[model samples]
Target chain A: MSVRHSMVKGMQNSVGYFISTFLFGIMFGVAAAASGLEQWQGLLMSGMVFSASAQFAALEFWQSPLPLGTIAMSVFLVSTRNILLGMSMTHHFDNHSTGRKILWLFILNDPGVVTAIRLDSGIDKLGYITGYGITLMLSWLISTWVGFNLSNIITIADFGAMDFAGPLMLGIMMVLFSKGSAASPIPWIISGIAALVLHEIGLPAYLILPISVATGIASAMTNRHRSHPPKGETRIKANNND
Target chain B: MTMTTIIMMAGIVYLTRVSGYFIGLQFRHIGELRPILEALPGCAMMAILIPAVRQGDIVDFTSLAVVLGMMWKTNNVVVSSVLGMAILLFGDNVISGS
Candidate 1:
């Protein structure tokens, strides 16, 4: 598929999770309002921070005396997984300028990264990632506005099911990512087991992604002798996606 | 104080989001590490998803199965997510006996 075609597919994938994320943003907006942020402040923060876990954690520290150090640390700790997520995309951004790739990091989110990694091996489809990221960001901001204005519609179903949307989105996208006989499942299994065990053992949340990604990469490297990438997997020209 | 806190928080989060890519680009000489890089998308993906799945109740497990089954049958991303959510919301409520 052409890079443009891939980009369109990615946007469609983002839209698939749009409702869940929008509801999630609305929930965050309601939380922000309850935490003493004004509607504009909530929208502004959502746009800039662009992280659900960080924003939600910040709400817990929304006292008259804001604990800047503690609040920033919590945010940092929560989002540190993005480090691994961004690293995984580095190969996709190889041909782009370093500055451009770094700038692209601004739009990185769970959904965006999942779609962005689907960029064909030889192609630099930065536009695909940007399109996916922007769609999610706008949905988040717009739904924040809705939730801020209509917090009364909080409803009966907003408690737990709303939260599963994130994971469900992840699960659905994983299905998309793993769909084929060509890819090996062993690395995925290893990474998942390692990460889950580490998490259950109470490892710091920030450490999970890096360690798990490292584990998967290590296993894949060791297994490369067993199953190599089919030929033409090298850095081919962008024109030969087929 | 609030504005300062917001900016600081966003800055910290943004740093994590970009740090790995930053390090990767800074030293592109590590051609030997390409397999590790190739392994990352799947590893990182499962790493992110597994914890949530493990923490979930039966509703989540069922919904996951529904999504996977739908994907297997239809090969559609958008519809699978929507249908998954619908099943999750329906199943969650039904399981709760509400």
Candidate 2:
């Protein structure tokens, strides 16, 4: 497809999660208002930061004295996924120049990156990813405006069942990524259980993602030989290696 | 929050988003590591979602199952999600005896 066509497709695909993104924006906006941030400040943060999880954590710890260190640490930790996401998408961006890559990565968010990953590599990925990211960013900014103005009338309960929308989005992405993955379901199962156990064991929330990811990778590597033995599976293994 | 804090947070997030790409660029020639790299996205998603699922009760689990099932069948994310949310809302009301 042409770049413009791919861009339009990207925006169209984003329509799927529009409600969830809107609700998320409202949640952040309400939180920002509750935490006493001026509307412009909230919108500015949304524009600059562009991460719901990090912004939410920042608002949670927003205070009179402003524990800058704790807030900063929380933001860093909550967004650790972005690092892994960026690394995963490195192949797609490898052909682009550093300036273009950095400029595009500024608007990176989960839905955009995950959708890019789901799309066939043959497509115009740069356009699709950029279009999707820009759409979500605009939706987030507009929803923040709505939620900020209506904070008094809105409450957390107003979200209700829609609260699950965010989780559902993540779950869908997981399903999409797992469809033709080289690692099989074993790694995913291991990672899920590992994350649960680590969280139960009182591991710091920030440590969970990296550690569990490492565990999943290790499990996949170890089970690789068994799943695809050397005899007749060499071709499959070679393909997987690529 | 102050402008300083906002800028700092944005800087930190931007770093996380782009640093991985640069790091991966450094190791591009390692063909052997491709499988591991390919595995990162799904595994990361699993790790993040599992704990959140654990926190929810029956309604959440059922709704999640519905979501996954719908995705598996229809492969339309928006449709699956709307159905899942509808199920969740219906289940929430029913389970609460409302």
Candidate 3:
């Protein structure tokens, strides 16, 4: 398919996310304004960071004179997942030009990357991701601005269970990422168990992602080895037995 | 927040965004790690999701199940999500209210 075609398709796919993102952005703007940010400051934050989760978390720690250390740590921790996300996209971005890579990565948010990977194969991955990113960024920035302006009128409580949207998207993403393969469920089960155990045992919240992912990776690796029968006669026997 | 703080936060997030790609690039040629790379995204999703779901009440659980079932059946993220959210809103407002 042509790059333009893929880009337009990407934008179309992103329309699904735009609504939730726009709502969330308005909510963020209200929260940011209530939290003592000027209109420009909130806009700047939305524009520069472009991460709703991290921006929300940072707002929780927003204070006068700037608790730099606390806010920085919270932002970093909330953003840690993006690193893995970026890593996952390496295959898609590997062939693009350096400038393209930078521009694409600049707008790389969760919804965009998830959509890029979830969509059908054969389209121009670069164009698709760029389109998805641009759409989401625009939705976020515009909604945040709107929310900021309407802060005094609509309170955060005006939205009910809106936070659930993030988790819902994540859950959808999990299904999308694991739909085809037989053994794919194994890693998710492992990751879930690890996350629960770590959280229950009082591991720092930030540590959960890395540790659980490692366990999942280990399980996948082990499962891969087990599924592939070892050596000669056993392998043939295993295949025939199947 | 000041420009400096905003810059710092942006810088930190931007680093997270790009570092993973660069890091993955390092291991890109490693034939052995390909499976791990492939599994990373799903695992990461579960790692974040499981705890949140665990902490949630019945409404959250039901909605999650609905979301998963719909996605499994249809493979349409948008529809599954909207249905999930609808269930969530319904459960929270209607069932719980009644």
Candidate 4:
């Protein structure tokens, strides 16, 4: 596809992804409000914090009046994977202007990183990243506000259903990640085991996240010999063929 | 929430999002971290998914059936989500007598 066509397609796909993801945030907001947060507080959490897992964790601990330090640590541990995402996409910004680069960096979320990796045309990397990020951010922000404002409209009976949104989204992510990969199930199995063991041991809920991440990372590193991409010209040709 | 609280929360959130971009750039020269970083998404997904799968309050046979069905039948996200929601609703009504 031409650069313009690619950019337009990227924007179109981004809009669809954003709308779906935004609905998830709205569901989260409704759940949080049901859990005791005020409508505006839920909105602010979705808008500012943006990490669903951490926000849900904070909501769970809200009644306890946990220390800010503890909350910060939970959020940091949950979000540490983004550092790797940012590193992976750094090459795409190598030729972009500094301002554009900074904006791209701000919006780099899971979907953004996945979409960036899928792009074949390098010339429109900035446009694709910008379009994807802005779409996702706006959707999340708007849906969160809507959920907060409409929390009362949703029944408490219905709120529990909204709690399922997090898992549902994660399930969808699993499906997305499984495409074109034979070894995809290995990390998933490891994670399931880690989660089961942690829960069995009665580990603090917040700590399970980091433990799962650590387990998966360690497993992936150990199995790197099985899936390492060939280097240099051979790798480039292989990628291009795909 | 108070304005101070909002500011604090916002600062923390922004720091998480932006720190990767800024700090990751500096570490590019290290070279060794790239392969490790490439595997991070799988790690993160596992982190989010594992505890979710094991939640005592939530997980049940019906949900497991739903997960398996979704993973096996279509693996299409939209379809799987619908299947999951349907199964959860059915399970809830049957289990809770609601």
Candidate 5:
């Protein structure tokens, strides 16, 4: 109870955070360069969007004849997960001024959202988000810049093992999320199933992640209710028990 | 040409971020939904990764093993990742050579 974990603390303490950011950043930069985008293009996209996963996904749509419509659709679909994320943070931002509240809307990425969600209670919410968001943004931009330039000198995939970097980072986060009693595996199972099924049905990759997440949450709610029944529902805590 | 393309891409992503907050604020008072929202990211990761693992080859499985093993042993993402990357690269190279 005494030792509190905030978004700020998570940002400072996690070594994986630094490595994953840089790794993914470089992966994005190199991929962009390989796709025939200039270094400046990579920087602009990374700086403006600040989402490694979506940026990576966007590269798939970077082919010539420029599927602008398709690319926009995919990026939008991929990033729509943020709506769920932003909603999750609304309570924390409800008390802040309008402008201050709006600031986080643009900066919140996946890890930043996770950090914010994990850092509940007895911490400066704004400070935590700022530290987490800004740190990632800078590292992402810098790595993209570096990755683009270095793409010429080094073969990107050989050095970075780019394919393995993202899933590895994700595995690390999945590990973090299961830390408490409430962090049940059932929802994850359900989500995975839903995602696979949707994929098999030919849904785009961008649409799959968020839809599956919703299905997972629904399954989790059902499991929670079944285990405790209505009488014990109030005892389930969001931190670990539910 | 690249500038226009990148800007379009950035705009789309930026809109997602901003739109999410707007949508999130609407649900602030719905206490029952909090857990669902909070848990979505973790579930999303699982959903996202499962297919990849299922579809991958030996190298992918090995990569998964390395990640889980290191994280399980160290209970530290940073240490495990750095170490896991080394194991994956070494193991992958050996397999490729063989």
Candidate 6:
């Protein structure tokens, strides 16, 4: 594709991602509100934390008065994917200035990582990453505030019904993640079994996040030497050059 | 917690987030840890979903129905969520009536 065409396609993709991400943000806001966080606090969490899982976990831990170490550990375990995401983009970003790389690292969430992996050229990586991050950040900030404010207007019963929005959004995210994967079911099965066993053993509900991560990592590590390319493989010859 | 306490808690949360960036950059070169890091989110989702499916203080027939509906309607998140809530409400009413 020509530079112009690629730019346009990138723009179109960014816009579509922004819209879906915004809806997901609204869902986050609703969930946060239902969880009893005040309006401004929810907005602040979205703006500052910028992570759905961490934010939700923090909210749950809020009432517990858990030690900082415990909270940090949970957040660390949940947000560990950012590390893998950072690795995948490192080759593409090797040539960029240190400041740009730092900024990218700061904003590297799942969507940003996914967008980076899908790019056809390394030249567009920074642009797409920036676009995805900025759009996601704005949507999260605004929708969180909206949900917080909306919480007061809606009854608990309504909020209970709407609470499904967050999980449903995540389920959609998983579907998006699983596209084109012939062996996707394997990881899902392994993770599901691990989760069941852990829950039966009396692990906390939030621990599921880390357990799933362990399961996926174990599965991936065990199969790493396989012949197939890992899932979400993008073709960026420029990346190799960088 | 008091308003002042909540505000302080929020500040701590912000610090943790900023800390993640620095931590990520520091450990960026550690490629050996990549697979486990990548798989954590999926593992977490499964962990949460398993208990969510069973009958208990939080899980029940209603929750299971919701999860099943979500799995079945993989594309329509809104519909699945609504169906799940409907089942929960119906289940709640039936148990109370009984």
> What is the clash count for each candidate, in the order shown?
0, 0, 0, 0, 4, 7
DockQ of each: 0.41, 0.44, 0.41, 0.38, 0.45, 0.31
| Angstrom error at residue B54, model 6 | 3.8
Kindly state the fnat score of candidate 5.
0.62
Pairs with backbone N, CA or C atoms under 3 Å apart (clashes), candidate 1 = none
Ranking of predictions according to TM-score: 4, 6, 5, 2, 3, 1
What is the TM-score of each predicted model, taking all chains together? 0.55, 0.61, 0.61, 0.70, 0.65, 0.68
Per-residue CA lDDT of candidate 2, range B13-65, in tens? 99988887787777766445556756665666666677767767788799899
Question: TM-score (chain A) of candidate 1?
Answer: 0.61
How does model 1 score by TM-score?
A: 0.55
TM-score of chain B of each: 0.61, 0.69, 0.68, 0.52, 0.61, 0.54
Q: Write the residue-wise lDDT of candidate 4 on B12-48 in tens digits.
A: 6566566766676777674555445545455555565
Question: Which portions of model 6 miss their true places by more than 4 Å?
Answer: A1-12, A57-62, A67-70, A116-122, A156-176, A179-191, A201-242, B1-34, B52-74, B82-98
C-alpha positional error of residue B49 in candidate 3 after TM-score superposition, expressed in Å = 1.8
* Weakest 10 consecutive residues of candidate 3 chain B by summed lDDT: B28-37
Q: For model 2, how does the per-residue alpha-carbon lDDT over A181-229 read when each residue is reduced to its tens digit?
A: 4447887789878999998998854577678878988988887767656
Task: Give me the runs in candidate 3 sitting further than 4 Å from their true place.
Answer: A1-46, A49-105, A108-132, A143-160, A180-183, A228-242, B1-28, B86-90, B93-97
Summarize candidate 1's per-residue lDDT along A94-140 as a digit string, tens digits.
66676876676687877677656665565445657766777888899
The CAPRI class of candidate 2 is acceptable
Better of 2 and 6 by TM-score: 6
- Taking the tens digit of each residue's C-alpha lDDT, what string does model 5 give over A132-239? 777777788888988888777645336444455556656765675576325578788788889789878888665776678778888879876776577445556543
Q: On lDDT, who's better, 1 or 5?
A: 1
What C-alpha lDDT, on a 0 to 100 scale, does residue A141 get in candidate 2?
Answer: 97
Native interface contact recovery, all models: 0.68, 0.67, 0.66, 0.40, 0.62, 0.31
Off by over 4 Å in 2: A1-46, A49-101, A108-133, A143-165, A180-183, A199-210, A225-242, B1-9, B20-27
